[model samples]
Target: MKFLMSILLVGLSAVSCAQNRVSQTEFKKLMKDPSAQIVDVRTSKEVAEGKIAGSTNIDYFSASFIATAQKKLDKNKPVLVYCAAGGRSASAAKDLKKAGFKKVYDLEGGYDAWKE
Candidate 1:
């Protein structure tokens, strides 16, 4: 029963995470808006592989992640976040929201999904 409850809680968290995520098509549409802010939360090494054109790379793993985001991103605009995989981007989106960003969008399945 405890294991089942844990699974249920994990499933619920996943559902909530999905709510903030967008498919590549939707992400592209959002990107078309001039007010969109693209933030790549991948590490420097991962970014060397290439990123979406026009995205600002902000390493999520860095100790100064939140500080850098606060300094670099506009809280008033819509933020589109992506990482090597979906996990970090999802985390970054939550952090952005807590940091007072009005709109936050995560890349579902991350950059891998985009490449697909």
Candidate 2:
């Protein structure tokens, strides 16, 4: 039981750690480079609620999310994605990376953290 608990804790922490995630400040810096593509992986309703300025909206839940991003973004460039509070963007970033995006970056703590 103790071994199982230890393993679970390690797995959970590894999942929660966002080594690939960058701060809003870092995202802004990355944006200055033409090789960065900024994306907001949130629904239109959430975007209507307000979003990161200059980010392109691609609904993460949509079946076309990956396809749309692939067509829109340069595969050689890094992808920087953010959702309202980070969760969706992280998932989307992973998908983007798996889909052959060279570099996938997520906004740590998402737009909420960025705004504040």
Candidate 3:
């Protein structure tokens, strides 16, 4: 019984910590919220090409990724994250969730999809 209870608790915690993945449409709608913080988790070189307007670039590969996010973003505000593709942003979203951001949204297909 104790083992079963522990498993259930772990499952519940994982669900609570899961970050949301939003489609381009949903992402656009969410961005309309003035309080939302948009984050681009791409390398500096990649971001130099192009990026979402109003997004703050925080390299996911940087050792200070989470720390930089924690410093720049408001924990109380919703965060929308993207990368050149979906991969890095997905990881960033998870990290942001673990860092205790109240709401984290990952852009599906990332900046590529947004451009399309």
- The residue-level lDDT of candidate 2 at 101 comes to 84
Over the stretch 1-116, how does candidate 3's per-residue lDDT look in tens digits?
Answer: 99999999999977764538888989999999999999999999988989999999999999999999999999999999999889999889989888899899999998887887
* Per-model TM against the reference: 0.84, 0.80, 0.86
Model 1 misplacement above 4 A: 1-17
lDDT for 94 (candidate 3): 88
Instruction: Sort all candidates by TM-score, best to worst.
Output: 3, 1, 2
Look at candidate 1 and give me any clashing residue pairs. none
Where is the poorest 10-residue window by lDDT in model 3?
13-22
Please provide, for model 1 over 1-116, each residue's C-alpha lDDT reduced to its tens digit, 9 standing for 90 to 100.
99999999999987876778998989999999999999999988988988999999999999999899989888998999999889999999998888888899999989877877
Weakest lDDT window of 10 consecutive positions for candidate 2: 12-21
For model 1, the run of ten residues with the poorest summed lDDT: 13-22
Cα-based lDDT for every prediction: 0.91, 0.85, 0.91
lDDT tens per residue, model 2, 1-55 = 9999999999886674466788878888888887677899889998998986678
Q: How many clashes (backbone N, Cα, C below 3 Å) per candidate?
A: 0, 0, 0
TM-score of 3: 0.86
Which should have the higher lDDT, number 2 or number 3? 3
What TM-score does candidate 2 get on C-alpha atoms? 0.80
